[model samples]
Target chain A: MSVSARPEVRPAERAEPAGTAPQPDTWRTRLRRDWPLLVMGLPMVITVTAFWWLPTLGNVIAFQDYNPYSGGIFGSPILGFTNFQLLFSDPQFIRAVTNTLGITAFQLVFYFPVPIALALLLNSIMSPRLRALVQGVVYLPHFFSWVLVVAIFQQMLGGAGLLAQTLRQHGYQGIDVMTNSDTFLLLVTSQTVWKDAGWGSIIFLAALSTIDPNLYEASAVDGAGRWRRMWHITLPGLRPVIVLLLILRLGDALNIGFEQFMLQRYAVGSQVSEVFDTFAYFSGLKTGDLAYGAAAGLFKGLVGLVLIVAANRVAHALGERGVYSKS
Target chain B: MSTTDTVIPAPGRGGPRRGKRGRAPWEEPGSLAGRLGKGGVIAVVLLLVIFPLYAILLTSLSDSRTVNAAGGLVLVPDGISFDAYRQIFSDTVVSRAIMVSTGVTLFGTLFSVALSVLGAYSLSRPGSFLHKPMLFSVLLMFVFFPGIIPTYLLVSSLGMKDTYLSLILPSAISAFNVVVLRAFFMNIPRELLDSARIDGAGEFRILWRIVLPLSKAVTAVVALFYAVGYWNAWFNAMLYIDDSAKWPLALILREYVVNAASLPAGTAGVAGYGHSVPPTLAIKMAIVMVAVLPALLIYPFVQRHFTKGVIIGAIKG
Candidate 1:
């Protein structure tokens, strides 16, 4: 959030060079220099304020004993800490916390390394044409709407799905993980792997291509085997990219997905499917408890903020610029 | 050099003669076994991605019986028919959804891109009026996410319920898009903009004539990103617009195609899968195809801009 800035030249004026440029000795001069840019920014200011900043203020409802029958925020009884207290006391909220953490952890472990592996493999391919073809096919899923992804999955593995029916024709009972709520976690995680891993590998692939190829040649001349060369040179080259994406992932860890869970919530039931986002939506709409939902959402947002800062600090400690630098 | 570990006979290997047929120093893993291993992994991944997509196309075009037999996906393409697509288009509910989605994507992308361009151009120059605060505010959004409940309440309270504005206005600007566009804008030579200023050209004129002309690639990329975003977004529609008729194609796909239990009541009789020419699954697959089609078409054209997009996006937060 830190800003390093130089003054902009207003269109109305002929601006001089940086060293000799006019600095406003008075507020009027500053205003004269600045107002046009402000005018240009007006639409965006309203857009951000109304959509993001204003709604952020609505989180104050979390501290109220909110009832929709009453007027909004001020009209509701002010119950300090009660809504949050109720949220923590509820068993459903606890399950949602677990589900959110569980999904994020599963993705961090199983889904995180997939892109790196794909990038390495892509980098190793001998023929450029074949490599491009593979890259094309793999990244296609990244653009799909999650609903479409869920639909395709359902069509594939639901009880009446293609494979399931094929198995039935052979007199074998078919497996339908789409309907099997017990394995829903694994199914969803695999969907994430299928949908995103290849697309995610792009940054790493770009990073890999930028590595000085002569280093590998030099290492080979030193009689270092392919394995040793990879571990020493290639991995080190990919480290900065990997760390950047990893830090970004930590900031987004709690986002352990909403649309996927929302689409599939009916199949597995809310208990298993409810993450922080779906929890907010379901409680607010389905349960008719806006205040409680806001409380849960606020709690998640605050925790996410804290975790991102902490993760960035750790990344800084590890010598990678995490997202952005303090300077 | 080290045991010649690979069975691969490097086609371009420079034997003892370094000058005659010297290989680039960087090329490695020229082993036959290694090549086979890498090829095998890539082939499997290719299938993993392609298989379902192939099945979807086949299922959408397959005659109803084959589609039914396979449950919903076809193993082979045969007796291809456009009946599913025809049926979907003929149905007003689905057709309207498509229209709504198209309208939203077009209008939303246009408005969003316009706003983002103006904002990015203004912010690209450092120390622009309120630049620090504006940029800092956007960066903070990455941390302090406004939640769904609050957002939903705000929109509903604003009387935007069931209106298309709810879908478009809330997502009018993406900070990432602004940052990327700003990066591109700033990369335009300062001397060029300065010369424009010296020529008595106004800020807007310079942006439109000089700056924008040079930034066509990034502008196209950012525009496509917004279009794709507006097209794919259904969550806002779901939360704000309860009228199914006003639903975007993505939401309709979610409801009728994906959610078997919640298909529109009039379309199906007792079976719920709807006994029809293009079977339920075929129609569902058709819906999925239509939902994914525009992106599939546009992505390859803009694919070259992706590396630039991602790198520029990363340059900020």
Candidate 2:
């Protein structure tokens, strides 16, 4: 919480011999100074209020028995915590929690280091042109829709697909990697790494750029080899960034891509692939239990918010800059 | 080489430096160990990322006989043909979907970038009335969103359902983009704004005339992001637009690749596998390539800006 310590203007602070301070032109001058900014911001205010803030009021319907056709949000029957109660009692909802947590954990353990490792590798490259070319090739996948990524994987690894066909040609059994429930978590994490590791490395690269050249030079002067210098100097320089990104990842752990899972849910079956976002969507939109779904979404949102705040606090405690400045 | 220039200074730092002459245990030049170690990393990266793309390209180019004969994994096309791409282009639904995707992406990117720039500029001001609250609200949106149901309900209530606006308005300005643009705006010197103000140029004029010209890098990156988001968007289209004809390229791609078992009859080619209209591995690959090509084409031009564009905004928010 970077709360500014600036004091609000007191009447005494502006006092000019008591009576001389009362000038009608002062208000006009202040308005003139600020009016352009206010006017410039008008469209955004209106747009956010109408589209974002007003719709946010609809979150209250989570506490009501929301009937879209019968009555509007205001007219809906009050149902207290019944929606939340329903969500808690459901087994599938519990599974969604476990599945989401599982995915996040897997990503943290496996997917998180990929970008850092890639950044290190790219940093080690002596040729700038080759580094840029490799980066271009790698980062291209990040912009692709999950649909295309999944489709590519399926074309290569799905049953009766390229990898399977290759296996048959080699007189080996086909690998069932895409559809198998047991391997879905690994599959998702690997796919995420493939798509994002290069793009994610940008931050680490930025952080790497800020590292003092003197440290490496000093290490070289001390007869330290490449591995020794990298382990001590380079890794230490990257620590703050790693912590910052880790905290950010912790914050977004719950939002492990809705469309990615939803598109492949039918193929892999919801029993394995179901996550909090998709669960909320299906229950709230498809099933017409609006309040129930809203409760689920709200619940996830609250947990995510808490996680982010807590992570930020922890980072601050660890003496790092954290996600934001704590002035 | 620099590696061997200064190696005999000290021994307390670590083991002997791996100069050009003194190769380390890991750097066994011309040895099986070095080749295997370096080769493994390169091979894994290539197999994981490049091979799928290669498989898709080869499959899309190959004839049906070559495809089936090779068991859908042809490193090289036996004989090249553009039949799959030709077939996709001829299909009215897919062609219309492509047009819809293009229109949405173009309009959405323009509107989003304009709004984001304006909003970000205003928010970047030091003492604007709504600055703090607006900034906080935007950050809050990043964590506790109104989620899918409420957003869908809001979209439907606004009567944006099944319309192009449904694809654009609800997501016209992303909070992340706004934050990024605001950060970029903040980096502009306050003296510039003051000078513009003295010259009788309004905020919008200053933003347009000065700020924008200087912000070409970030603006291009953000616009490309918005365009890609619009192009690849399927969730909003899936939820809001009920009409199959209004589907975007991604949704169509999703149907083809994921829901392969449910593809319509009579669409199956002569080399169909069974009653399922078994989407030839080639068609899936073709659709995947089609979906990916737009971003790939636009990315290189904006690649240089990505580091600055993503980092500055991300850090601030």
**Fraction of native contacts (fnat) of each candidate:** 0.51, 0.41
- Worst lDDT run of 10 residues, candidate 1 chain B, spans B1-10
Candidate 1, B52-145: lDDT as tens digits: 8888888888867787666557887668798888878877888889999999999999999998898878777664557677776665665678
lDDT of 1 at A246: 78
Please give, for residues A1-327, the per-residue lDDT of candidate 2 as tens digits.
010222212222343343443333354444555566667666666666667766677889999988888877989999999889888989999999999999999899998898899887766554556567777877888888888878777776888676787787899999868889989998898888878887787777766766766676677778777678889988998998888778777867788888889977977899989999999999888888888888898888778878877876787788755445444
- CAPRI band for model 1: acceptable
Docking class of 2: acceptable
DockQ of every model listed? 0.33, 0.27
TM-score of each: 0.90, 0.87
Candidate 1 residue lDDT tens string, A124-181: 7756567667878887888888888888888778777767878988999988888677
> What DockQ would candidate 2 receive versus the native complex?
0.27
